[model samples]
Target: MAGTTGGAAATAPGKKGETPAATRSGALKRLPLALLVFFAALLYSQIQPPPSKVPGAPGGPPVTAPRTRLRDGRHLAYLESGVPKEEARYKIIFVHGFDCCRYDVLNVSQGLLQELGIYLLSFDRPGYAESDAHPARTEKSIALDIAELADNLQLGPKFHLIGFSMGGEIMWSCLKYIPHRLAGVAILAPVGNYWWSGFPADVVEEAWYVQFPQDQRAVWVAHHLPWLTHWWNTQNLFHSSSVKGKNPIILSKEDTALSQKFLDRTYKEQVRQLGEHDSLHRDMMVGFGKWGWSPLEMENPFAGAGDEVKVHLWHGVEDLFVPVQLSRYISKKLPWVIYHELPTAGHLFPAADGMPDVIVRSLLLGDE
Candidate 1:
């Protein structure tokens, strides 16, 4: 009887079954909560202002330079600093790194500027702030834009270039495309090419983020959902104190204070424009993606002119973001790069006390 079913079993409800009404009731009970959450998220998104749109917000410094039209009709915003009359001496055009704008280099000490006797220029690369997005922008295309900007500003036939962090990629492109236009090139804590071989054994070991997905989630988001990347950066503003915790040894008291001042002025200002997100997205995409050219393909432009264009590579030995070994590899590959590996320094050292002066002076004023 227990094992077998009677004729009545055929008409009975299936074993362990709940009535259809009960299932429908359960879904109905959960519906209100789901709707509540949906509407809450919708409201938050609607009311929350974009990071760039907020007034007196924390980001980069405000745009102080006039926006000029390039040959392609896109607007290129730039800041010109230093003695305008000193233009006869080689000009310095600064290329900013991730999350930075033209204002990044504006904080260089007044004493240093007066001492160097060099004209300084910095501009928003395509898409970072006020600069128009170039959807087809490659590293070489960016070089072309710089060439156009150089011509527009009448910066002579050549100028010294300083590329910081991710900006180094564009600097590499400049070397390939417009070497003749450069008086010298300097890279500070530059991002290394992924395709380059002979990476130090410790590179993979030291670069824990490369192995850990959670650590690199922000970068992943920047590559996939740039809007979210902008929102995250906006919500979590940069503070020099943040660096203090992570890099205790790298920043001295003077360096920390200078860094704080620099961040206070430039961080919020860099992201004030709506186009910043687009620019940041493009930078990440082009930086990690195929560069469309190789550093090996480039020849020293000054070689033919009977002079060697100075190449300076400065990297902090303790840099966790970009391994120092990469710089070592790059120096070896290029052979001509004058590499400076600071033992007590980290990635942020370039922006630290006396370092900016050192960088500008070493290139402009020479070792003297």
Candidate 2:
């Protein structure tokens, strides 16, 4: 009886097993599947991200505030602060940087603006806020838009411009394209372009290396493969902006704390209102795109204008967003610009308490 069970279990394995020849054939049968899987994975690895699709009308709540019409019939929305335009002794147009909107201006005191008679104008750039998106936006077109806005507002022939971060970067566009329309300009912690041919190779390399790896790739895509920009930034699977609103590591510890004074939730909410395509993506395209001219190549727009004209650049040595060397090079090239290097500050220094007032005073009153 035991033999019956043992015979089945201990008999030659061939009782229930395939022959060596059969096994060989089975392995051969699996070869195509193995190869198919291997090739499929290989192709997947080489595949690029799909191109970005057109973003529909923005998703945020409708903006109820006033909007100025541009030359091309696009409505440009803005936030007004401080004194009335007629009563304003100092007319300031504040420009916001990446991942920001019209409301991103420094939280300056109404009392301060009142006492100084300041009219602060902060506007959403094309594709931001309630402003109409411009598919053909270019560096020169943006500068002209600001100039035309001034004419439409009767802010006089020229107005003071104060821009920070990417906003600071756009001041260069005005300098290049519409300097005659500017009374004075101030740029704080502006971003720099790595592809600027004028920079010494070694210096540019050093500055470029300081950026976070993600930012380096973002910049590379923005400058080199611009067509992939929308997908690179929107796919969210890989690429995103370095200056992530509140978590921007590019700023210093102190600057991060200082920035807390302003309510950023609204800023971020409004920033995304128009989608990244027209705002951030367009910013990268125009900012890092082939500008054909660098800050080094620009002429001193205020050179012969005496004390009546001024160009101020404020940079902090502690800034990781824009390394000190880049600003130093700009200062060296444009000797007429009053360059202020803050030792302990970072990129967001302009947002510090009382700091906005100080910057305004310097521009309007000088060293009085």
Best by TM-score: 2
Report the lDDT tens digits of candidate 2 across residue range 35-66: 99999886555433332222233444576668
Q: Which model scores highest in lDDT? A: 2
What C-alpha lDDT do the candidate models reach, one value each? 0.67, 0.79
Model 2: CA > 4 A from native: 1-61, 236-239, 244-248, 262-264
RMSD of each: 8.0, 7.8
Name the TM-score of candidate 2.
Answer: 0.81
Provide TM-scores for the models. 0.70, 0.81
